[model samples]
Target: MTQGLDQQHPQEHRDRAILETITQEGRSDYNLVELARLYIRYDNFPGARQIQQDLQAILAQWNLTVEELFTLTRAIHQQGQIYRRTKSGEDIQDWS
Candidate 1:
């Protein structure tokens, strides 16, 4: 039974272990964003909301206005999509 369970969701177990390590190291906005992404990917909306709250707080503390942050987030998301589509796995090239 234990082996069956282990084999059934190996990636989930790995993700949990990684999350545990990150939590033990203490939470940060960057960590929260990563957690949110992981939760979203796994279809865990509640967990993602919690992380999003943390991210909001961090953005507030940094005095990042909502528009600026949204712009940054959109750019990052778009870049990731482009990289994934290209399959070259290269970093996004700087325009300036």
Candidate 2:
């Protein structure tokens, strides 16, 4: 009998473990879209919410406003947006 994804990870009992892997394991960092999918995979919406809050807190450390983070997140692509240049072909700067 096969178990589930939650049973696969060693730290399944630890709620923080999932978030920790996002940073420590580095494979699942940010990537909220991916994280959401992962949460769905594990059938863990509650855990997903916790992870979302944790990620938001981490990003808050950057002093980014909610609007800025919203713009940086690509909902259509379901991925994080990394801006290298503005629409005018200039490098992005002075983002707060």
Candidate 3:
């Protein structure tokens, strides 16, 4: 039988504790997007309200506003990467 995450990885527990502390304090020296991704992934977990507040606080540190961020993300998804890996100037038909 597999054990729980806290039991299997003690370091993970310590890291989570540190993340919780930073989130509650609304501060992080790490990449804001990475930190925000973690919070977003656990949005339905305990202390969700605090997570939402922390996301807003972190976003304020970024140069782009919420709308601008969304717009840029949308553009990237729509336009794909700046460079293609294929030598042929045709879209790869078989994604599989």
Q: What is candidate 1's lDDT per residue for 1-96, written digit by digit as tens?
A: 232332223245555564665566645444444444454444423233434455455446556655665555566666554332335655442211
Better of 1 and 3 by TM-score: 1
Output the number of the TM-score-best candidate.
Answer: 1
Write candidate 2's Cα lDDT for 1-96 as tens digits.
222322343233454554566555543224443344334344433334455566566456545555554454455245534335778877452221
Clash pairs detected, candidate 2: none
How would the candidate models be sorted by TM-score, starting from the highest? 1, 3, 2
**For model 2, where is the 10-residue window of minimal lDDT?**
1-10
User: Worst ten-residue run, lDDT, model 3?
Assistant: 1-10
Ten-residue segment with the worst summed lDDT in candidate 1?
A: 1-10
1 or 2, which is superior by TM-score?
Answer: 1
For model 1, the superposed segments whose C-alpha errors exceed 4 Å read 1-10, 44-87, 90-96
Put down candidate 3 lDDT per residue, 1-96, tens digits, no spaces. Answer: 222321222233443554566556653233333354444454444343444455566567655466655555555546664334568675432211
> What lDDT does candidate 2 reach at residue 45?
32
Model 1 scores what on Cα lDDT?
Answer: 0.47
RMSD of each: 9.7, 11.8, 10.4
- Using all chains and alpha carbons, the TM-scores for the candidates as numbered come to 0.36, 0.31, 0.35
Clashes of each: 0, 0, 0
